[model samples]
Target: MNRKKKIKQILKQKAKKANDKLNPKRKPRYVSKAERARQEQQVEDQ
Candidate 1:
């Protein structure tokens, strides 16, 4: 019973850590439409 409680505590701690890691909002790098078009044109030309 004590071992089960300990395992539950460890599992809960791990779940909390994983949730913290997964929930944070990440900012993406901004790309301009002109730059994207230029890249696509270069690829097509090649």
Candidate 2:
């Protein structure tokens, strides 16, 4: 019985990891000063 419980717990953890990989959360990206300036210039040109 103890072994079965441990196996089930391991399976649950693996499933959770798989689910997380399938549906990832959004994270903010860093923007360098040069890139930001280029973007601003493009907007001004348009």
Candidate 3:
């Protein structure tokens, strides 16, 4: 019973770590008007 409890605790810790990594606070990618113009210029230069 003690071993089973320890295993459960380990599994719970692993799950929490996985969840934290899976959902991270990050900024979404967005292209501004100047950035769009630069990209277009790059394409034209190519």
Give the TM-scores of the predictions, in the order they appear: 0.49, 0.54, 0.51
Q: CA lDDT of each candidate?
A: 0.94, 0.96, 0.96
How far is 13's C-alpha from truth in model 2 (Å)?
0.4
Compose the digit string of candidate 1's lDDT tens values, residues 1-46. Answer: 9999999999999999999899975887787999999999999999
Task: Look at candidate 3 and tell me the lDDT of residue 8.
Answer: 100
Write candidate 2's Cα lDDT for 1-46 as tens digits: 9999999999999999999999968986889999999999999999
Best by TM-score: 2
Model 2 alpha-carbon miss at residue 36, Å: 15
lDDT of 3: 0.96
Off by over 4 Å in 1: 25-46
lDDT of 3 by residue, 1-46 (tens): 9999999999999999999899986887889999999999999999
Compute the lDDT of residue 31 as modeled in candidate 2: 95
RMSD in angstroms between candidate 3 and the native structure over all alpha carbons: 7.1
Please give the distance, in angstroms, between residue 8's alpha carbon in candidate 2 and its true position after superposition.
0.2
Residue 11 in candidate 1, Cα distance off native in Å: 0.5
